[model samples]
Target: MFYISCTYKIMATFLYKCRDVGYDCGFEFSAHSRDDLMPRIRIHSRYAHNIYEMTDEMKKKVEEAIKQID
Candidate 1:
């Protein structure tokens, strides 16, 4: 009860657009955290686009592409 009362709203949404990454994939994903969003994006990238691997720089690019929504 105390914890709940003390809790503040966390606005931690992440947004990614496939087109922003120069793809016609037309896919977008949103989640509360990067950890929550990456797995789904990885699976989608692999199965849908045959993108099997993401380099550290590519991961950084993806992270850069993410937008925060309040």
Candidate 2:
């Protein structure tokens, strides 16, 4: 479609990191493909935002680990 043509590409943003809680948690910021909004991440209520976005050093560390995987 016209919109698709206009968009060259979209950068993925790991909206959050899922860790230090009851279960493994967090998100990875990998660009979305044609059929996906976030190609490599899944949304969860706990994460809220990418762990990297967090100001806390410890939390950021968690996010960094996720990034390394990508």
Candidate 3:
């Protein structure tokens, strides 16, 4: 007799929308994890919105705005 095992992986897509953070801009970003999405958001905030630094409040807002979809 022989036995076999199979494994499956599910990936969650993390999404962030600028509007969710009170921005009127229609910028949307998606990544596999928050770690990956934040850097891109930081760059966009600096270049597009002239946000040189992310305040603790802003970081909390951003984190709350992130949505995860599987």
Candidate 4:
């Protein structure tokens, strides 16, 4: 007889430096995934930069700058 157990570990931590994309807001965002960080950034941008909406290209830029952190 043989017994087997299956388990998986998910690493859910990433670091997104605001300055990476050439923004000097002095803000850094960390989240389980990039999908989670975007909204926070958008809100921050709204209050900090007074930008109500982000362009598609800007969003792409942000996605590109995200780096996983352990």
Considering TM-score, which of the candidate structures 1 and 2 is the better prediction for this target?
A: 1
| Number of colliding residue pairs in model 1 | 0
What tens digits encode model 1's per-residue C-alpha lDDT throughout 1-68?
35544768887898988777777878999999978888988898799889899988778888887888
**What lDDT does candidate 3 reach at residue 33?**
98
Tell me which of candidates 2 and 3 scores higher on lDDT: 3
The TM-score of predicted model 3 comes to 0.88
Question: How close is every model to the real structure, measured as TM-score?
Answer: 0.78, 0.24, 0.88, 0.76
Give a tens-digit lDDT track for model 4, residues 1-70: 9999989898779888778878886898899988898888888878987879888888887888889977
* Full-model lDDT for every candidate: 0.84, 0.38, 0.96, 0.84
Question: Which residue pairs show backbone clashes in model 1?
Answer: none
Residue 9, candidate 2: C-alpha displacement in angstroms: 2.5
Off by over 4 Å in 4: 1-10
TM-score of 1: 0.78
Better of 1 and 2 by lDDT: 1
Candidate 3 per-residue lDDT, tens place, 5-62, comes to: 9898978999999999999999999999999999999999999899999999999999
Clashes of 2: 8
Stretches of model 2 off by over 4 angstroms after superposition = 1-7, 20-56, 66-70
RMSD of 3: 2.1
The superposed Cα distance between candidate 2 and the true structure at residue 17, in angstroms, equals 3.9
